[model samples]
Target chain A: MTTHLKRWWPLALLLALAAAPYSALPLPGLLDGPLGSPGSLQLIALCLLYGGLATGYDLLLGRTGLLSFGHALYFATGLYATDLAMLEFGLGFVPAALLGTACSVLLALVLGAVSLRVTGIGFSMVTLAFAQAGAILVQRNPGGYTGGEEGRSAPAEHLPDALIGIQNTANLYWIALAYLVLVLAVVHWTVSSPTGRVWAGIRENERRVEVLGLRPYGFKLVAFTVSGALAGAGGVVYLLLTGGATPQAAGSDATLALLVMVVLGGSGTRWGPLLGGVLYTWAAHRLGDLANSGSVAELPSVLRVPLSQPLFLLGTLFVAVVHLLPGGLAALPARLRPGRAARAAAPVTAVPEGAA
Target chain B: MNTVVLLTCTGLGLGALYFLIASGLSLIFGLMDVLNFAHGALLSIGAYAAWWAATDGGLGFWPAVPFGVLVGTAASVLLELALIRPLYARPRDQILATVGVGLALPALITGVWGSDARPFPQPAALSGTVDLLGAAVPVNRFVLIAAALAVLLLLRLFLARTRYGLIVRAGVEDRAMVTALGIDVRRAFTLVFAIGGAAASLGGALAGLYFGSVNPSQGTGLLVFAFVVVVMGGMGSVTGAAVASVGVGLVQQFANYYTAAGLGDLSVVVLLAVLLLVKPRGLTGRLA
Candidate 1:
């Protein structure tokens, strides 16, 4: 009973924390300040959306040990499908989102079945190629549903009133928050289940798992489908927030951004991706804004130019995280606490010696 | 008949460029388990270097080619030594690190060179058209084809006859055995990476001449193409990379000729996906 309570308490606390801003209850000064701003609320919502995407990505990457370079194909599909359903078919958000996610799952199953034939880096390359192909097709807009390069916005009349109306900032935030919780709950349930153990085994050694009579390929495909569905769901939230979808959202850049979130937050941990997504999105947003018009502009042309490109800093951050902090930001608390760093280092130091 | 011949020639020229980039990619992966995502950046750097040498340094194309190769080689060696060496045992981290480098380098290129693409200036002598099978082709196109063939022959001869080539091949087959045999296999990998960088840069310089212009974003697209070629050829097979590159180049060229604006690129990617689905080991790769 105690163990079960301990396990459930953190989740309950997290849900309350997420809901706190929407509630009328007064909070601490620091929390109250940021929660009150419409812009801050919107930013937080965006971070949650990204966090949700990263959580899904970790299912394939961290659990199944698949590095899919084209996962954005699913994201694009979700957004595009949802947009088309709402605009062209006159469907509501819930039905449109469900339909879009279904399409993304179908696409993932097809892509996964074909790609999983090649292991490791080959899988990454195949997925990348497919994604690139998908991006181009969307850019071409043969059916005119995608709106080509300009990217069509949901007409004000077409959207569900709250999503894009004047009250949108708060409405979008709550909606994104709700989706985030749902996605996280699903991921947590899936990872803790018996199936997730098989995925973990496959990640460690496919041949060994195969020898044990488990089908690694089918398991990987299921993980891919689930991850794709989650990413597609994130896309639906993104549509709700921005009211539009661009081909760029499904490009390799977005894939890299999502990868950074997953890796930075702690790839295998349940809460790590969510933490990473929020931190990364917030940092990127703040940094981009800060660099554009602030003290950065005063620097010399040579100095400012490289700093001006937001991705340079992002890339540098990713490298630093990989090299210095193998476990990512989520591991920092354990490392930073007194006496814990030594304890962590002690076991790690013995590992290489044993291998050698 | 003219269209056919012209398209064929166009395809070969593009194929030659693809081979230059893909062969190095194949070789580097063969020797060192490193994917070198930054290789595309090396190509772009080479193109920009040659462009700089020709326009700013007032050097001729021939001199600029070597300069670009040198710069590219140095950069690649630096990357291998400083960044890649420590992460050799961890492929996933290596991929991530290299990807970070890949992203950073292009942004750096944009910062240094500005965001705009410029037309690559060709030498006055080679810019003119030459007659080929009742078709008018640029002299530079023939020049590119010859250079590609010459490089392929040299590579073949090196692999077939040289002691170092034998060592590289032996290492690829079994690194542990080669290490036990007292060869410093890591040093050989560094050499292979340098050579790969040189090849990519040379190709980049020539690609600029072929395509007539380049920009920072060019590396990203080229990286994808190189990956397709490497995969289609089977990883770690130089000869297979060469053959697959030609096929890819021709398909891309023909697709561009027949299709609307962006579909050519789309078709190339689709072709790679379909081919990969059909032949996972690539056309000539060994299944270990």
Candidate 2:
């Protein structure tokens, strides 16, 4: 039946993506090399890593309706902790990753408790302040631990031999793919359980849930903790993909980029954030390539300048999506179908209003 | 003792800049419930415009300030009308739109101007140092303080004496009630945005003088501090912003001087967190 096919399609897609490393198909415009090439695998792995991150972030934004502006803090915590553990404490890869994830979870619990005290925009600002503090700490590189402006790279000796060189990029790609699958499975399981139903209630109308003798705070905290944990794990993978922990991962801009990804994908919908993440990462990389390709150099300065910057184009595209496509790219298919337009056009996520 | 005086003066100067940015941010958030994330971008526009005017447009520093303010105000008004007005129904979208603008404008600035910091043209009169409490303080600090004081006074007078100011205050208190009273609150929103843009742009111009150079990321870097001031001062209270700005600035200056260079910034953020956790309603206890 079509229903069974629809339900099982994700598994099929997963299988196909898992086998992508062995493919030598040359996609001319989409990538610079064949599918199995180290360069292509690296880009794909990065995209997959972000896809996982965006999905984790949606645990707060889409499911629980918490607009956290400090998600990057946890991500950065995972990144820096893993790198530092390896570099300073002489921990191997697995142990360092576990420690990093633990740190992120602990930070989320502590900060989430403080931030959740104030509802709505206050919570957002509080999280932002905390993240800003973290960013400042990293940038100051107290006692030269964080490498000041330039981030510290992972110690190659500490990492596994398979994850060290360019030839092993496919292994990294597999790790990224595994991360995405894990997140997808966890998010799918959680969002369907009883706790997930409560999250839905919290997202829709917290007052109603409270009136029914339930505590919204506890539910929200769980969501925040789990989301933070997933982000931390993603950070570990990101370190493997990129080979370092950069301060950019801790900045507010990084959080904003995640927000953009979730919104662009269609918040609250399965697979939307993943698709958006992959698409955005690909576009940004391709655009950067195009900018440096000297093609735009021939144009007038006015056109050439805007074309050269990937962020400008992405930001503008994000705004347009926010305006015209309220439900994001996920809603596009439904919108195109006859008589389903109105239903699909409605915003997928119920954003809390006037709380600032 | 002289070190303390110099630090206090410099901190106050920094606080003045914070006030300029925070006051507008407060009013806009108070009135529209929109976070206006692009506020930093507005400051950058003003700074870049003034920088261009001083160097490429052949305008002196005195004339360039007003020119920058003008351009900033125009850009903000356009943003309000074109981008923000359409999404009045969707508050979150409004914030997202501003975020987009925030990202895009800075990237545009870097693309056109390059990422390097450009030296601000110092007016001969403002470049010299003046002895303050036996500490040689830069004259530009005094200029910034004077400008902030003037703006503070003008803003208070406008809020207390003008009819538009009355509408703004009322709208902040209860927007639906103001609409029920047969008033067009949207006009006040545009006006507030304009006012905020002008103040932020002015801050940007003075910030250039204070820092001795202007860069694309300067406005955004200061924006975090401005957010601290805004939250500490209460969301919509102009007077509260002025007081908090001075407090934060002084704390940052003294802490940075006595301790680590970045510790002051960290302390200010800590202060904001503590204040929010303690009071939640801010110092003024006035809700937007």
Candidate 3:
């Protein structure tokens, strides 16, 4: 009965979240307005969007243990391609999104083929270099397409009428919710499938998989391509939410931010990245708001300065998490339950020994 | 002809700065198996400290460089002891922690000093131009090249002659053997971090003169090129870093001048990609 309840809880939660728009519930301290208000919905939508993104990124980092630092390249590709398709080619929203996602997938396949040739830190560096190239291209704003550093906004005429204007924020929020659900479904299905077992094998010990007559490279590449594709789709949602593409979206820092999110959430776990992504996005936005609030301003300069910058606090928190919480927030519940913690710890310690 | 001469001079000067950052990066990665992402933050700290010393501390340009180097070295040492040393068991986490430091330090810098570029105080000696091969080259360029040369010579001497350097060299080649030989490899790790930080900080101080201004993001901006140099030169090889630094800097300068403005940076990245794909072991055949 308990196991059955645990399995069905997510569905129950999804239903409640879906009905959130109709409820005028005011979440004090967590949000400035009522739950159904545009302002609150917008923030929640951004959180959901990142939660989906972090989930996608976890496919590589958590499931496959491939630390590609260039995840932002694919995301930016989706964002820029979609925006440019609408602006330059006059394509409608759906077609533009499809084209952007295609671009991201194609780029991922090619780059992944090249990068997977090397393993470990070499792969990380190579991916970083490639992403830096992409960033430089966007920043260069060749032919004024990328708008250089300032970036370009989405062409409103090409977007569907429903996706535009402030009143349609709920629609955007729903779209974000749909994206998170789609990603969760895809990731959940893939992680449980045969390919996912192969990924776990590769993550634990690539040579063992090879000895078992399998090539790890192809499996790794599939993970990369799928993750990249998901990131691309997320980018389209992000463009809708923010109303534009910025060069920052294409940068190494963006990828680092994703890394922070995934790790903070707990990389390999099912709900970890999603919870992390939502909490992190919420904190980032709320911290920015709090920095501008009068109470923060009234504090001493030393206190005020660090509080003013969200990234500083976030980065420091990440460091603390790495030091104090190795398994991330996902492991916290397990830690609180001592009997379950010991049982969980047993297998985790045994796996390394078996692999070695 | 004059344009070529000027570009070459400036490129070599740029190469000098890259070498300073790359050399330390190579050593740290080689000895510790750590890609210290915070290396860039060290450079930024150095630049800020030097800028602070020269302007606010009233130390002037000549004395400010050492002050910056001292502060940067201290910070690097503290980082190694506090953050990195504890994470010795987890190699991946070490890199992540450095990434954290890399992120936080810049944000802190920006918080303290506004994000705007502060005009670097230039010494009169470095402000003037020198006639070099019919090109009016900035004296600062010559200063940078000279500083790089001195560092190269000193580094080579230390590595070739000193006992600690010998241990470092051995540690890079076979860490297990060095540890088995009853040598405390951890001490050498701290020393390497100190050396890398000092060199990077020194680069930061000189970089201010090179750019004529200091900004929080300068270290991170140069860090990409330094990574390229580290890859090209092969990890842990000082002489290799020197050669690759010159090659990368010249190529970037010439490419930027000959082709489009930003294409040079793109080309350099392309060069790194091609090089890695072609020869995974890098120039010196060092896999690390």
TM-score, B chain alone, candidates in order: 0.94, 0.98, 0.98
Root-mean-square deviation of each candidate, in angstroms? 3.8, 1.7, 2.0
Query: What is the clash count for each candidate, in the order shown?
Result: 0, 0, 0
lDDT of 1 at A273: 80
Compose the digit string of candidate 3's lDDT tens values, residues A189-209.
999999999999888888899
lDDT of 3 by residue, B1-288 (tens): 999999999999999999999999999998888988999999999999999999999999999999999999999999999999998887888888999999999999998998999999999988999998899999999888998998898888888889998999899888999999999999999999999999999999999999999999999889989999998998888888999999999999999999989999999987787777787776333422
What's each prediction's TM-score?
0.92, 0.98, 0.97
- All models: lDDT? 0.80, 0.91, 0.91
Better of 1 and 2 by DockQ: 2
Per-residue lDDT, model 1, residue A200, is 81
From the highest DockQ down, the ranking of the candidates is 2, 3, 1
Q: Which parts of model 1 are misplaced by more than 4 Å?
A: A1-35, A341-356, B283-288
What is the DockQ for all candidates, taken in turn? Answer: 0.49, 0.72, 0.59
lDDT of 1 at B140: 77
Per-residue C-alpha lDDT of model 1 across residues A275-347, encoded as one tens digit per residue: 8888888877876776677688999987787778777777878877877777677777776785877766452
Best by DockQ: 2
Candidate 2: regions farther than 4 A off: A1-5, A342-356, B283-288
- What are the clashing pairs of model 1? none
